[model samples]
Target: MSTSVVENLGPTVQNVPVTEATAAPSALDTGLTLGAVVQTEGTTFTLWAPAAERVELALIADDGSQRNMDLAHTGEFWTGFVPGVGHGQRYGYRVHGPFDPAHGLRFNPSKLLLDPYARAVDGTLDYSSPLIYDSSDGDSAGHVPVGVVVAGSEPPPPISRPVHWGETVIYELHTKGFTKLHPDVPEHQRGTYAGLAHPSVIGYLVDLGITSAELLPIHHFLTEPSIAARGLPNYWGYNSLGYFAPHAPYSSSGSRGEQVAEFKAMVAAFHAAGIEVILDVVYNHTAEGGFDGPTLSFRGIDNRAYYRLGHGGTMYDVTGTGNSVNTAHPQVRRLMMDSLRYWVEEMGVDGFRFDLAVTLIRNERHEVDTVDHPFLAEVAADPVLGRVKLISEPWDIGPFGYQVGNFGTPWSEWNGKFRDSVRDVWRNSSDGVKDLAYRLSGSSDLYGDDGRYPYASINFVTAHDGFTLRDLVSYDHKHNEANHEDNRDGTDDNRSWNCGVEGETDDPAVIALRKRQMANLMSTLILSTGVPMLTAGDECGRTQHGNNNAYCQDSEISWFDWSLPDAWSDHLGLTRRLLALRAAHPVLRQWHYFSGEPVVEGGRKDLSWIAPHGGEMTEADWYDGNLRTLGMFLAGDALRATDAVGNALTDSSFLLALNATAETRQVVVPDASWAPAYEVVLDTSNSMVTEVEAGATVPLAPRCLVLLRAL
Candidate 1:
């Protein structure tokens, strides 16, 4: 059975893939299971390729032997059941169809395509050769990865207690990089899923007081041909090829299906330590890349049905990668939802942090769909996905892509605004406290009216894409010459200050000032009213050596330097202290936005901004550009929350003071009406914790943050 395709893979969806009369069959109609499903008798391989006239499963033996079996075509799906076949078998598919690229049909029988739903994958793309490209019908069997059959598994062990929304603290880290150089991790396990779940790793997280470990992309991904051709590695793993399979190299147990078991065990370990695992997923695009790239999985199966296409059969490129996924496609949506459920139900992962999430909701016309988009709506309605932590990077590189706070209701967004504002303040480049005030208080202007609370803002100063916190204070500009792109690839608009010296200076005073800036940035991130996300080693002086964009450098530039712990104890200690404070104080991690209204009769405002003088801040103070020294007061009694047992939740009110100016500033504590007295709890200036009398003035050093508790 064959079908004529559209002349061009353009914006129009009507004439794409195949006609609507012969579209891919719905699972509800056929009840046909997809992918290689293991049964007691044999393994059945089912694929959805409506346009293909012939479909064959290419089973590869470990010794490079190959066998091809024809799949029985039925209702737009092809099925092949092989008896005596079970888990650990490596296989791919050969789809025979029209080879017209102009009509979005670039099927080549020679290119052995992987199953999009492969539970595990083996081998990497041989990017050194031109034959890897799907340009001709030349054989690509050995060049691309093959799918490994995963065992039919038992239900994963359930998490006893997941962290609640309001009190959750996120620690983002690259799985391999986080433990690659860890002294305590086993030699073999270092830089694998096993390493991330090592006892010392889990113990460190528990000790640091973070409830969630947000791992960077773990999906089976490919090094871009360009990056790989340049002799650089795709360290970030954002170029996703297999969503169901974990990256093979990061598997210590083996990739012939043991990687699945190892990943499940890793998640279980984290759950046992009272920490939830959050995956950074890239569903926006696949590693198949643009028209001139390789045929991995999605491209060979059904090109037009899987990817968004532009005029003249050109691929619609968003996500700053090559191709934007066809989020409007029903089967594509099903695949995503299935992958998500597989991780949560079978693998026992707690949550997912979607990369370039806005692309996931683009409509058939390639426009943003915020209103009841099928994918997001399905996620919100799914009993499994809805309950877990749902976070979005929230934007793509498409038209009108920077929708930071626009992802409404239950979706927490990476607060890029918070990072910018905090960086500006600590670097003393900010115009005033006006924008910083908005960010420090959860960016109410962004999330307040949308029925969202403070937690919706995932406050982060440094993440995988940018400079580490240490480099944020050390590099005045991005030094990405190591990326091999002549330093022109990374963003030049880094709002970083080098603290009177550039890129690792030996001057003690400059180093000290950089440390203070690091502390100030971290302190603001934690003390701010949001879900604070700490970049892995930000608390312990991790530096990319001025390479803001270290996505391709998998060497020491991207890996965490475990040796910094002993050397930078003060910064690490300060981060731990701030996290402890956030865990203990309900007022700090408020679920509700502050109204600034009185909590009780004749009481002070629930929250207030303070002036240099011992008085409430006037409008002029917020607008003044030179007013770097300021204070934020949170009234503990105004939390208006209760425990599960229904008892009223109340605690001591606190004040956070900031001095970003060059000189020491005196910040006066408010009288007893706001707090009985204030005591320094955590000081970025390395000041000792001390009690301050009511209405007393506390000295704040330059580039320092002081958190004071009510006595």
Candidate 2:
């Protein structure tokens, strides 16, 4: 889509007027004027300069032609209506003011400044001593009145498509890691935004049934000083440099505005395919690390205002990324809120998953407060952002960091317990059946009340942070040797089992067992009563060569191999079938916690656990570590949807039997009042099941799961 086409697709839902600023007395009216040239109504511009002694809009043409349009100063805001200057126009503000840093004024008339609301920036930020704050000379350095002209242009391409929340299933992925080795993406477009938007990439996502792709941090970021010296780039892109600009490295076209266009095109294509786009935002910290770091946007703008400091002007490392942003500050909070609103309104993004969100909620006293935090409360209440799918990493590396269930209602979290518990139950040890039951039932122990539903807890067996599903079942330990960290990095407590073999093997038995284990993990994840997140490439059995911390290895160690053998194809097919089953069954995706009560009058409970002997589970049976044979009976009539008067809506029933023991056990089908005969729908012991006679016991294979539907 062209920029003009995007501009014509106007009036998004997030374009609400700035109500808070309009309701209050103008701060610019009482203070020195600051200039702003806002483009609205296509080809028309409005300029604002509060304390400018004189303001002029100098349009710099491509051939070095210049035209000075004198701006009109209204009540604090300079207004103008320029026709010829539309998209792709390069301009800057020339304002005359005192240049002082100690008293917080660095407005140089000679130094042309880019518009703060510029949708797209045009030039690269060349690192030089000129961009630093110097206090060497009296007036030229300390409060320098030097001409520092940095190249910039009008805001980038406008966002055309904005999908709603209810229709979003966010798939968080790293841009570079996603397409670094994508076979179909061209060599030039391989790690760029264009690559992610390619038909091949989008086709995979469409098949996966995910509605939104939540990309990891894409803001222009800097490699850490320590990491830079070792010649390592920040692969995660968590440390942001420019909020408005797209990361230059991910742009295949290399044009200043092309990145914006490409990113928008990606969103538009996804929207066209009925999918949303979410960004994993990092506002907790910046690339400007601690006291001794580069002075980027926020730090250069106002160090004390933007960052939390310790006693005697030291830096407080709350996010473990050095300087923690002082989101408690009013202006700092405005910066973050404005950034979020900008993405939602102008970038066509549907939602955001905040990284280190707890840091943003920290108050001025350096204490994390969910209630009093203005920024958090503002986002939760803001009409433009309130309805957006707001997810939180929900923790930081600070004191009392793990805030899993702390985020208030209308917010979902990455359930770490779900990841660990599921992994432990299937891959670590089979002793935690009771713990696995809690996770499978939507983790009510963590988020049961406050109107939060099961979807609020995003359950997953594996994520980008750790081992892939294939690796989890194949490697007993993390292989971080490729990271050059001497295998010191990555978590040691992976709770993974090698299944009697380490890494890849030619042993057919081991390979077969691993594939079955992968199926089991995927089955549990999709069948669970919460939103399941499947890591990219997990369906095709992607492996990171046993490297859990492959964040630095941008080569094959992280790239997903789409090419698979027939066995792998079968596993992928099974994964797809499991996901389809989950989508088809209302009993599997219950919004509320399983009440364990019957919906039908005088019928069986909605769910009933059974022992190998076909009797209802007793306390002793549930607690027995050796007793791994378990069965669950789900009543279709009992799980029916109700009207205002609580009546049945749909009829479906099934039974799931799981045998985690080393020895095969007989799973007796109970002749209950609700279900008299059960038909085999899925049997992991064999490739397919034809039929099983009613009341005829079936021998469940060791470490196998079987599903049956009532006939």
Candidate 3:
């Protein structure tokens, strides 16, 4: 008789009815193992313990009762199943192993270890002596074997829905700071996952014309001991604890699975509104710091396999977080790749923005490989991940960290040069116009012949890490005293200038100049050729009270104030108009690099640089720092058109004039074969012109940018 037949019988009844006459199974079901049952049911668990001699599973109940289950091995995998124990059950594992730090193996079975496959972790980790091995004792060289089980439970199913890429405008935001002060969200839901998915929150994103919300890390993360002691939390969640589990602190509901469900619901609601969801992933390092740091998941599991260690088993501090991940190791590389795929396939994410991406491509010697790194090739070749948008921060704290345009083809990098150049041209002295011109034209000099398009440069003047657009024009220096760092922290060279006053004042002229500067920055960003990323609150003129580095402020200092004044409302209107203008014109968002020649036969040049007098630019004009006035004539018909073979293409003609001097300048309309008439489509001079006649000498206001169309 088969043991399966006997196990099928209930505990209350010894003999059950058997229809088949071929067999009569015994009551004792010793042959049917729990591991075999779990394997048959398509569920399995895996743990890495290179130092462990034995491992066991301990199941805990809500009423403090416990059940011990011995694990059965299948290769390196030790797995088992409790017939009635599944998804929502609370369980943990214990490993009996050595504590030889000199050999890089520190394991204490006395610690109740978290399952690496756990979808969610219940409560916060409590630091205790039982979690560590005493180095003073003789047994310290070899940790004693013991195990403790803790209570935990998973939540119910989530509402699943996935959105695609290409149509997504991701809004990167921190979970707590995003809705911590939102008046519409319930007090309990504030700063939680539930609040992020609330109808009002979703409505705000929809109103902003954004198609995707790229959230900062929500994974279980460790708060640095020093930061905790200073009464500050980790504002930027670069420190990760568990990859599969969601952070319990971000959950409004107490259930572990509820966090997962709420996160999925957030994606679903955004999808229903024709939006996508991308995640800003930090896989460069774990929360485990150097020698003095706590024993966490990766450190306790298989430190050698997970981390890049130095000579004599010392931790390598490449990520600036005490320890860097060994992506060169095949197993470590597999872990990262699997984590990314899991989020895309299971959680329905549209894309990923890799933090400190250069560190992930480091070779065996810990040197970053820009051209042919194994991890980079793996991600690019992946079928499930290939279609998704891959954005790289492209730099790290290591040597040769500035890799703005160094990433390979098919990867878009955060263009820091574009940000700094544009800011310097508008806010700094007049020595940056030449570099600004290079950035405005898709940064072709940086990404010219790499088989990459203009969009490969993700251009922006402001991001979450620096000043808001309002602060960029309102203050000259970073005021980080509110961060409790005595204002010594953050970047000293902000490249910002207060038109006249240092801070806010009742001076009408200063206020007007600041507003105009805001307009100038927005116009430059939108009109430039690249993928433009607007910081969420910048459009509405949100400020951080001059806090450039508000990493710890969870108060109103970080949240976006919804009730903006009428003046700010007007600015928002202008921002929308600029975006619409960018979307309306193909010349502004060209895919290919400017050819410099006439795009159309018998037509004007694809692009022509001119002086303020409307004459062709001289070599001397390009070198002069004081010559800030210029005109760019774009030939619309000169744009190349493609056929079925994907050849080069062309399009109509357009003209733009810019003047940064203290007085207005007369711009001449150049003679072209396309037409004799030119019409003004947009004029920042008056901010009210719909259209103007061509071939007319227009008086461009000081520090103004104007757009014209050929009729």
Candidate 4:
């Protein structure tokens, strides 16, 4: 906001002073609102292109006719007021300037740039058209995505989520793929935002006890030319084209500014169902990719200031997407912050999960600035972004990018170590139970030392990018031939194990084992002491046929198959049961990490790891690499927390035993100090819920998880 803040960003023009920056920062980003602002009588277009020699406004009508208008340059921004051009006016910009790629200034009036802050983006880019690139030197109006003017409206006040933070259950889902094949949803509304917000869909999530829906990238994106050439689409929507505009294709309503209203209604519907909407936002990179990529909004507007360019203006990509955004630039950061605020203030969304978030806070030197950075500093000082939830993927391909626990309190990170450790534990490949113990108990090794609590770790065994629950136990290697990249697109470090078979088989034994593995992993995910996130189709049986990299496959491979087959009914029921147990019990969800000591005088420890033979886990048990059996005892009375009504909280104690070895495990119940009696509430072996005798042995099948309640 101040001049010194700009100077502190970096030495390059990427962080130049507001008045001296190549791109217009003082007028457009410093105080003025960027993009199309609809007024009472007309609309005003504002853009940042301080290096441009000339700028013109192209207003396109419904019939495809356009009228040219000159924008008055104020030495800081190019703004023009077009009378009678209110909402629903499709438009693009033509900025005439130098086309010096060496210095990162690639402005070509031939390329019609979409507004960097476009509130509504309509239509798709004709990637095959040569005029869309700077090489053509011809008009690119019809071949590019046009921004539609949207009149701002007041969104309803956000509904308060009744669930506690500790009880949060995040369901990561695709906006369209979630309801694509729902048998109950109407045919017309299927696979659209309207379908996702249908009462049927909302009721399904409510019955399953989901607290939030983390939708993947509703931001408008473009299908990469390479993918398009292969007759494929970017189904994951990671290549962001418009940050403010909701992905138009996902809207059942029209895309001519109607997507905005439809998206708002969807949010309102989810909120009324007591489900918070958290967007899986991609702000680390733009669809305008590498140096040889197409001339999109940022590149044609101000390439040097909008992207992290290296020597000779080469794009510095850390997202593995060819180009990374220049958040170091004051205006670029403002664009990102503005998009975030707009989503919160206008869209009625609850939070965001920033994809490849570390790229957003990197300095001009392309190094991560963990402390005193402008991005985090602004987020902390802002009123809007402070209260809303902020999650980070927390890693990139850049140097020291694996900053899992580096982000301080008030932010949650996707726990990569938790996923790896849990996978290893279930696959019977873990060296010892030490890592699994830490992960199951909220990963205190990663988040404890920071000023954050147990909830800082967003624990998940399977996310959108990896194998689904069913596939995790059905495939040993990736079968990604459908991706068409010689099976080299997705990550090869998938810690999956085929249950005695490589692919789908008719053997009932292997099928049974696979389903049981899914149940076991789901149980572990829900019972863990952190915010649990479930991939969209994981609850039921959803398989990508070993295609872990289904980002380009929008067909049946990625959509949620809602038909509950006979094989997955048990697993789905178990998932619901696990979530219900989590919600009903207070000890299962703790605000703070377990102290492993008595919270009150003469009480059992809050948490204790027990050996199969009984009593505390000894050092020798931990030193054994083959020791895969683990028992965790949670004492209800030892928790130092209170209910929402401020009453001291107490709950029934629980004991969970997991065995991942070849031989079955028989865990002896602890002494009277832990629990007087125990009952089998859930078991992965046979879905049995029965009572166990006092101080009796609980039989756990190999690679099975059993949870019991202390009586």
Cα RMSD (angstroms) for every candidate in the order listed: 5.0, 7.8, 8.1, 5.7
Name the Cα RMSD for model 2.
7.8
Give Cα-based local distance difference scores for all models.
0.85, 0.67, 0.67, 0.85
Candidate 4 local lDDT, 625-704, one digit each (tens)? 98899999999888889866998788888989888886777777787767777888888886444876556766678878
Kindly list the per-residue Cα lDDT of model 2 for residues 112-210, writing each as its tens digit.
344434445555332333432222111111111111112223332333444333223456678887888788999999888889888988888878667
Question: Model 1 residue 293 lDDT?
Answer: 82
Put down candidate 3 lDDT per residue, 1-711, tens digits, no spaces: 111101111222112122222332221221221111222233333344544666555555665344544554433345444454444455556555666666667565444456655666665543333333223222111111111121232322222433322223457777777787788999999888788888988887766666567788876676766666667777767787666666768889754466667776666666677666677788898877775566645666666767878876688777777888889877677667777776777676677888898999888888989888889888988987886678899899887777888887778888899998878777646672677777888888778768887878878888888889899888888888877778887888788888878777899988877887788788788778777778777888889867788767666778777676345987787777776666555676676788778766776777777676567777777887877677777776666545459865454567766776667777766654435776676666555255545455667777677777777
Model 3: CA > 4 A from native = 1-43, 58-60, 63-70, 73-76, 127-168, 430-432, 565-567, 600-604, 616-618, 639-653, 661-666, 672-696
Query: lDDT tens string, model 1, 447-470?
Result: 897889889999998898888899
Q: Estimate each model's TM-score.
A: 0.95, 0.81, 0.84, 0.95
Off by over 4 Å in 2: 1-118, 121-170, 428-431, 565-567, 625-627, 640-648, 687-696
